[model samples]
Target: MKNLANNVGVSTIGIATFFLTVVVVVLIEHFTTFNIFTLSFFIVFPAGALICGAAAASGYYFGALWLHRRPTILIFVQILLVAAIAQFAIYYGEYRLLDLGDGRMASDVVSFKDYLDVYLSSTHLRVGRGALDTGAVGNFGRVLAFTQFLGFIVGGIFVFVMLRVYPVCEQCARYLRILAKKTQLFSKQEDFTRFYDTVFEVPVDGPDFVTLMKWQQEKDEKAVRGTIQSETTLRGCPHCKTQRISQEIKVWGEKEFRDVPQLTRHLRIPDGIDLTSAFKTV
Candidate 1:
């Protein structure tokens, strides 16, 4: 029952943000002639559309943060619906505004399909630093249709990525509070290996865990050849105080550092164990 209430609250927030984003975007584009929704790269990737979609769906992000709850699949589907409607609203708003600007009294009289056809007919892709016009490719209407499809895809992808990337406390239905994070740099692979074993092999409540968690090192440019970097993070549920630890190790290459996925680990601390005291120390 509580989850149901949360879902309702989040949905309401999402709807509100969606409308606000649409109005702001439509008005900005109408006045500036920027066509933010149709902004693209290489005539395919909807870069501008992604920004607009994410803006429209931002309620989900803030809603989850404010409510301290993870969004459900139902809310995700609602965002997609918003994305579709947002695309239509953008184009329709543009059409109406253009007619009004032309001193037409009956801008509402034209059907949407007819307006879309006219809009596509007049549109052409420009390329190169010289802004060379590519003119119309064969069947320009189909091309524009595909671009609209990409807009929906951008919206869906943005929300989908946000849902997965943010960590949440499932049992408490709240986002985890990050307790501590530190990155340690090692001049030797063996040093990092020793650190890794100390973390994974020992119980987290032990004194060694406290000492290791406080470990720090300053980077030395002289030791570039065998250097490794390890990042450690601790998160706890605000309500339940359930704690989790995650670590990722990266090897310094000739040019950059790359993750060693096999060396990564995420562990849940046993119940009744609270490491807040250890983290409180410098």
Candidate 2:
């Protein structure tokens, strides 16, 4: 998890951007009859949900980029908080725009309970439903809250999956740079020989007598080191100061060939064997 207090700057900027988006959406709804959903509930609710999701995704991206960590649970909670605040702002904006009675707006004097009653009544009218009691209105509010929360989750997951599947270096969390590509071939050789040698000798008499025997033996066996032939790519990560070598070994008994120009081939080593040592004669 991230230290929320330490990220106050980013959080503050994110909150401010969300509210700004909400205000623009509210103004558009107020001046024009633009309902996000054909069913009532005002355009503000869906607009707020979208803004909240976007804000949450941005938060997660920035957290990963700057802090090298994305705290999924914390970001989700932050999204919910942003959505709730946006909903309240939308309600308050609409309340001020509405004339309650005697040329007075609900923003001037209406209590929270009275606001809910008015808001729910308008919702019912827009949805073509009959009057709803306080209990029904409360239930509808919970359902709306739940749907908005789901929107935030969907947005967060979308961005998270994109980041994971993207071609990036695991260690540095940055894009990888291809350093080199080459193919190699490996070979081995063995040699064996049979020979005879004196096996033992015995003394028959202390002064002059001696005997000798011979035996057959195998010796001077030699084996060439196994060589690996492969096509390999060398990649480096600039951010984490690391390198990765990826190789695809050629199948055994395959003939090796160089596709590059002769000059280029001369400059590069063959895939599997080291030319300097392989060419040396013993």
Candidate 3:
């Protein structure tokens, strides 16, 4: 029942956000003479469309955080629906608001379908400082439609990716609060391995664990070839008081630090475990 109510609330907020985004997008395009849905400055890259999509997807992102929504297939479908509706709303809103000279509104004279056809036929691509001639109206309209659709789909996928990466407290039905983030650097591979073993192999309340917790904070810098970097993130559920720690290992590459996927680990901290001393700098 609680989840249902939360879902309803999120849905309402999302709807409101969708309308707001549509209005803003329409106004922006009207005043600026820039069509975000079909904008592409770089060759084959729909930068403006993606930005518009991100704007449209913000509602779903915040709504999820409001109730700690776990992204499911249903949520994914809802996001896509929101994307489709939002795009339609923007197009229609723009059509209605358009002034077709001599105090005439586009919507007052023509139906939405007719207006859409005219709009697409009249649309031209802007290249640099001049307009680029799109040979045929039909081909240009098709390309525009394809770019807009692809951008929204990619935006929906990004929302899901973000939600999945964030840690959530399933028991409390809330997003986990990040407690602290600490990093440890090692000059030798064997030293890092020992450090890894100490943290993962030893029990939370063990002597080695306490020793590690008391270690002084280290300054973060670019890793050298022989150096190993371990980044630890601590998060907790406020309601249930459950804590989780995740560690990611990185090895120095020719230009940057590359992640060691196999070295990543996530561990649950027992309740009542005092972590204050470990995060002195936090």
Q: Alpha carbon lDDT of residue 196, candidate 1?
A: 84
Worst 10 residues of 1 by lDDT: 217-226
Please list the residue runs of candidate 1 whose C-alpha ends up more than 4 Å from where it truly belongs after superposition. Answer: 68-71, 99-111, 136-138, 164-166, 170-173, 219-227, 252-257, 280-282
Give the local distance difference test score of model 2.
Answer: 0.45
For all candidates in order, the CA lDDT equals 0.75, 0.45, 0.74
Tens digit of per-residue lDDT, candidate 2, span 1-282: 345554554456456655765566567667785533212244225544654456544554554444433344655566556644655566566666766559887767877668856565444223325534334344465466556656555554555555444345665566545665544343421111111011011221111211111111123422133333335455555565455544343333334443322212112222332222211210
Return the TM-score for each candidate structure: 0.81, 0.43, 0.78
Off by over 4 Å in 3: 41-47, 72-74, 126-137, 170-173, 184-194, 202-229, 251-258, 274-277
- Local error of candidate 1 at residue 261 (angstroms): 2.5
Ordered by lDDT, highest first, the candidates read 1, 3, 2
Q: Judging by lDDT, tell me the better candidate of 1 and 3.
A: 1
Candidate achieving the largest TM-score:
1
Model 1 error, position 173 (Å) = 4.8
- lDDT tens digits, residue span 156-247, model 3: 66776787678887567678877888877787777676678777677766667756754533556546785777888888887787888888
How many steric overlaps are in each model, in order?
Answer: 0, 7, 0
When summed lDDT is taken over every stretch of 10 residues in candidate 2, the lowest stretch is 191-200
